[model samples]
Each structure stands twice: as C-alpha cells, then as structure tokens.
Target chain A: MAMLFSDPFESLFNLQKALDAFHASGWLEPGPSAGGTYPPLNVFRKDDDAVVIIELPGVKKTDVDIQAKGSTIRISGTRTIEFPQKAGIHRRERIAGRFDRAITIPFEVNVEEVKAEYRDGILALFLPRAEQDKPRSIKLP
Target chain B: MVAPQELAVQPKKELTPKEEKTVPARYYVPNTDIHETDEALTLVMEMPGVEKKNIDVKLENDVLRIEGRIDFSKYEGLDPVYAEYNVGHFSRTFALSNKIDQDRIQADLQDGILTLTLPKAKQALPRQIPIN
Candidate 1:
C-alpha cells in the first residue's frame, strides 16, 4: 500500500516545485513592470474567517486598490518617492513603484462581508468563509 | 554612491549583546533609503509591526544605531496559516563621519516608517564665495 501511494506523492511534490520556480522568476501575471516588487504578507485563519496582513510602507491608502472574488483576493498599490533636484542620493535600497499581488484562499469566502483596514502602513483584511466552506458539527440521531 | 545595506547581518558584537535581552531568534534588516541634500542626510527605513514606542535610536561613539522591537505577542494564540514575512526585531547601524552634525540628528516614526535626518556640520555645508 505504501508503494502504491509513493508515485502520486512524488508527482505532487514535483508539481509544487514547478509552481515555486514559476513564482520565483518574477514573471507572475500583472507583473512588476511598474518597478515595484511584491509586498510581504501574512495569512492567518481564526474560526470561520481568514485574516490577511500586508506590509506596504510608504504607500498611501488612496493609492491602494483591493478586489476580492470567490476565493481569490487581489491587491495593487503604488509607492512613490520624490527627492529635491540637485540633491545627491547617497544610498537607496527601498523600492518605489507599482505592485500587484493576487492570493487564493484555501476556502471559499463570503465576498459581501469582507472587511479591510489600513493602519500604520499595514493592511489587514478579514474574509468570512462561505456557509458551505465552513466546518460544521453534524447532529447524529 | 554607497549602496544601501539590504538585509545585511549585524556584526557579531551587536548580535551577542541583543541575545541577552528579549532574545529574538532572528533579525530582519529592514529596507532603507538614504538621500543626501545640501543641508542633511535623510534615511527612511521600513519596519512594520514596530510601533513608535518600540523603536530605539541612539548615537554614540560616532555610530548611529537603530533597533525596532517587534511585538509578536499581538498574535498570542492565532495560528499562522501562511507567512511570507518573518516576525522578528529589526536592527541596523551606520558609522557617522565627522561631517555629520550629531547634535542635530532628528528621528521620526510614523505608520511603521522611520525617518532619520542627520544634519551636516556648519563646516561641511557648501557655500558660494564672492569673486574678488
């Protein structure tokens, strides 16, 4: 029985590796052509809701656009920097440009009830799971 | 132009001292942007999850040190489902040259961004001389 499952598991691992490689190439759709890279983000599940936290320093709230559909959420924003003319820049490590990121939740989400908040350069999103996607305890007669 | 330090590890001495404190297992070197104007040098650093009260900026022995402590306790019992960023403290140091006006250095923290302004010394400021 172990041998029977090994082949499929190996194939699944290979598929995951391929997906990782694709993402690392920085060619994901709606790419960073605007000079911005993907912002760091975190996803946590609590009870029946999925919470997503994103770091977007130097980006104003007005510049951010978020859209959610079914189980996918898309976030896009722009970061701009302005320096005085004739001023010499000694060092620059922060990236300033437009960025787009799309994340797929593991479970279906209730689109209408999703809530979002931006504070302290961080964006937090609360997505409630769909009725059918949430786990329920069944009553046994 | 000096390249801004990106995710550079702290020297051993700096790391050893912090280990005795809150004892964070890791440190994330925050991305920073440094700009020099005729008046001063400005540095902007990105450090999310670090509140204004938790940031420490010190200048001593001609070195400017910045450390931001992350409050991981905020997530106390929440299980992490996915994470693309690590939860840890942020630290970096810059050696100040004699041209910097150490006494006038100013720092501000807002919305997770730290801005530091290091003014230039009077002697270092450029001035136009009248032609004789």
Candidate 2:
C-alpha cells in the first residue's frame, strides 16, 4: 500500500483534493478559519500520523480543554483580557472571549496515542491513525 | 446556531514588504491593543510561537521597533496539509513622543503577548489645579 503512494507532496495533494470536493459539492464557502474559527489551525501530515498546530496567544494552558473521539477532535478554551484599573483604551484590536472548535480529519485517530503540548501560546496535537484505519495488504492467489 | 462572528479569530494580516530586506522572508504584524492611564501608556501585542530570547524591542530616535522571530525549527519535517495561517516572524513599529519617559519603559512577555509600559515624563503627567 505504501508503494502505491510515492508522491512527496501527498499532503498538498490531499488539500487540493479536499478543496476540489468542496467545490464540486457546491459547498465552496469560506474555510472554517477564514473568519469563523478562533485560534487558526495548521494541519500537517507526517507518515501515518498527523499534527495540528493552533495559535492561541494570551491563553493559559489551564483555560484550554481538548477531547478526541474517533475522527473528530474538539478544542475549547477561554481567553480573558484584563486591563489596569481606570485604564482608558485608546486602541482595541486583540480579542478576548470563549472559543470552541471541532475539527474532523480523514482518518480515524487512536485516542490512546493522541498527545498535546502547549508552548508559547501555541498548541500542537499529535494524532496517530487508528490500527483499523491503516491500509491492509492482501496477496492474490 | 452560528456563534457571533466577532468572537472568532480575525484573519492574520501579512506585512507588506516595502523594501528588500537583508533576509528574504515573510513577516506578520501582530495584533496590538493600546491603553493609557494616569501614569503610563501600555501596549499589548500578540505574537504567538515567539520566545523571549527571539524578541527585540528597541527605541531609537523616538521610534520604537518591535520584532519577534518565530522558531522555524519547530516546524521542520512536517508537511503542511491545510494552513489557515502562515508561520512567519512578527514586526511592528511605533513612534514615540518626547512626553514618554524613554528610560523608564518596561517590557514584559507572558503567554506570547508582549506588554510594554511607557511611563510619562513629569511634565506630561496630568496635574491638579490649586486655588489660592
């Protein structure tokens, strides 16, 4: 099965394929992160596993919650912006509120093997494909 | 039900390259919030994926420049499939007035947000009037 897929840009190909499918289905609406998703994410594939990187500046680890089930993962967190007493805001651009996002991947993930790390206000999730989702080899008689 | 759009993450803005730099790399402008109090002005900037060691805050000739270089090594060996935002260094500049106490400026980094405190000079502070 691995021999059949030799393209080094498999990840990009998959992305294009996903976009094509969305276009064909008339679901070519803007991407979830275009303006509706909090804490934009970047998905990457490495071997049979995948990693999701999220940018959540000013969010503490204690405020974030992650859950994985089958092919979908949920991330929920709250961001609080505090100002000094009697502060007069001149310019406000940074946002603060509760955020929750659920994302689905192509392959089922092994919940036991899923790991997450938050560093410098960025969250990285390592998800391994489930054993049953792996391609099985067959020999022709 | 769809959540309010304002609560979602705003699109990250890419810095427009005005001139050629020594290093050819894309840069981003971090979102910033400015607030003022009786004593000082505070600026909060969001620069995710940047560490304290990789950040530079300089004040030269009444211009304050802030830059944070992202650690690209953290992304090595990973092939991007779907990218909602690009990974790049952060750069933003602000002009300061003489009313600001340049020597008393303080900076602190916490949870990827840089907080800069610029104390006002003695003459710049608001003073109460006295009636004889």
Candidate 3:
C-alpha cells in the first residue's frame, strides 16, 4: 500500500490520502467512488482492557486526531502524501481521505487515561480500566 | 497466475524497503483476525466483494494458498471519483511448519469472513495423563 502513495505529484497524494481515509472506515457501492478494504481493526480483549490496532501507515502522529469519551473512542485524521510535479507516475492505489472510526468499549473505560501509540504503520491503543470495573484479588481459603 | 492489472496497480515508487521482504506480487488484502483458543487456532479472514464461484484454497508443498478475485470490471463504465479500496485480484500464501494435516483442513466463508479450522494433527494434540 505504501508503494502506491509515493507519488511526488501533490494532487495524487492528496486525493489518494483522502480516499484512503474513507477506505479505512470502509466503503460500499462502487461507481468511480469506492470504500476502503482497510477497516479500523478491533484486536483481542482481556478482562480489563480492550486493545484496538489501526493500520494507517505512512501517517504521522500529528495527522491523527483521537477522542475518548465515556465508553466510546473516536479517531479522525489525515496522513499527508507528497506528489511532486516532476515525478512521473504510472499507477496509484494506497489511500487518502477523512476517516472517522469510533469504538464502543464493551465495559466502561477510564476515558481520561487511555494510552495510544503510533509506530511504523500501526496504531495501538490501551484503554485503561475503571477502578471498580477491574477484577479484585480474592483472598485464598 | 499473475494478471496484468495486478502489476499495473502496485505503484512503482516503493518504500526505501528496510529489508528485502517479499509478499506475493499479486494478492488481495485478506481481512484476517487470529485468536488463540485453549484447544485450537481460529482464523477469520474477510474476503468481501468476492463470490463463492471464484474462490479456492489449496495447501501444497507446505504452503497454504488462497486464491480469489472480484469481478468488478463487470461494473466498469461508472466514473471513479474515489478509489481507496481497490481489490481486483487476490492471492496469499502461508508456509506451514509440517505439523498440520493437509487433509483435515476445514474451511467456510460467510458474512465476508473466511474461517479455516485447522485442528491439531494427531501428534500435536495435548493429552492429560490420569493418575490412579
């Protein structure tokens, strides 16, 4: 996917990134307009935390904007792709578009203390557990 | 078999390529999720926009190959304003560690996710010894 977005032509990268944003959220019904095959993935979960990893490589931390409120977390942002005028391009695919994905964490999350990290092309999020919601150690008999 | 469209679609300006890693030249991004259960491995792969008529799975030479394609050209003439997810042709291969039985592999694709049940081969299953 990174290969497709390497166009130096500003327009190509700009538009493709826009489309990719839309794709990350997913699209349906095609006719010059299509949805992305890349979905904001939901990873495995443990008792107290539910981890969500989104594959948005070639995107920078500044380009991404995220919000966590109550039990829902919303992500919205853009990954800039450069398109140089001198560079010649034969084909393009990657993606670029405004994408927003909000997940409803099964249990109430600390909302205030969620941790997020972006490395390479993957976004990893750690949703902390509320005090009362987390399991307490039971005394042995 | 490789297709022309597949080649043309993968843009040329590739990454600086940290390592010379190579995935299939032509393959679909199979939506996948792998979770380990107490007894087995559950693999859920999404292959939406693909019909059953054009999908198949084969494990040979210690490689698991899944091949399928979307017949979107049928819907061509339409203007393309945006194309973020363009999956025209697809193929993916995984090298097995020689522990799974090729014959016992079970698969099903429903609601867009292709699930393959790879039970532990006879010699790989765990056994609990009972003490008298």
Least well predicted 10-residue stretch by lDDT in candidate 1 chain B: B5-14
Model 1, A1-141: lDDT tens digits are 011113532432332233233332322223223322377666665777878877777778898999999877888877776676877787787766677777767678999999999876778899899998878899998
Better of 2 and 3 by DockQ: 2
Q: Give the residue spans of candidate 1 off by over 4 A.
A: A1-37, B1-22
B1-132: candidate 2 lDDT, tens digit per residue: 344233576877878755756554567899999999989989999999899999998888778899998777565566666666666789998887647888899988888899999998899998999998
lDDT of 3 by residue, B71-130 (tens): 443222222222334333445566655366667777875434466666656776567789
Where model 3 places Cα greater than 4 Å from the true spot, the runs are A1-141, B1-26
lDDT digits (tens) for residues B30-97 of candidate 1: 77888888889888998776888889988888788899876654553344555555455678888876
Model 1, position A51, has a per-residue lDDT of 83
TM-score of chain A of each: 0.71, 0.71, 0.65
Q: Cα deviation of A125 in candidate 3 (Å)?
A: 32
Arranged by lDDT with the best first, the candidates are 2, 1, 3
Better of 1 and 3 by TM-score: 1
lDDT of 1 at B25: 53
In candidate 2, what are the lDDT values of residues A33-56, reduced to their tens digit?
Answer: 333477677777788888988999
**Model 2 chain A weakest 10-residue run by lDDT:** A20-29
Where is model 2 more than 4 Å wrong at Cα?
A1-36, A136-141, B1-6
Best by TM-score: 2
lDDT for A51 in candidate 2 is 92
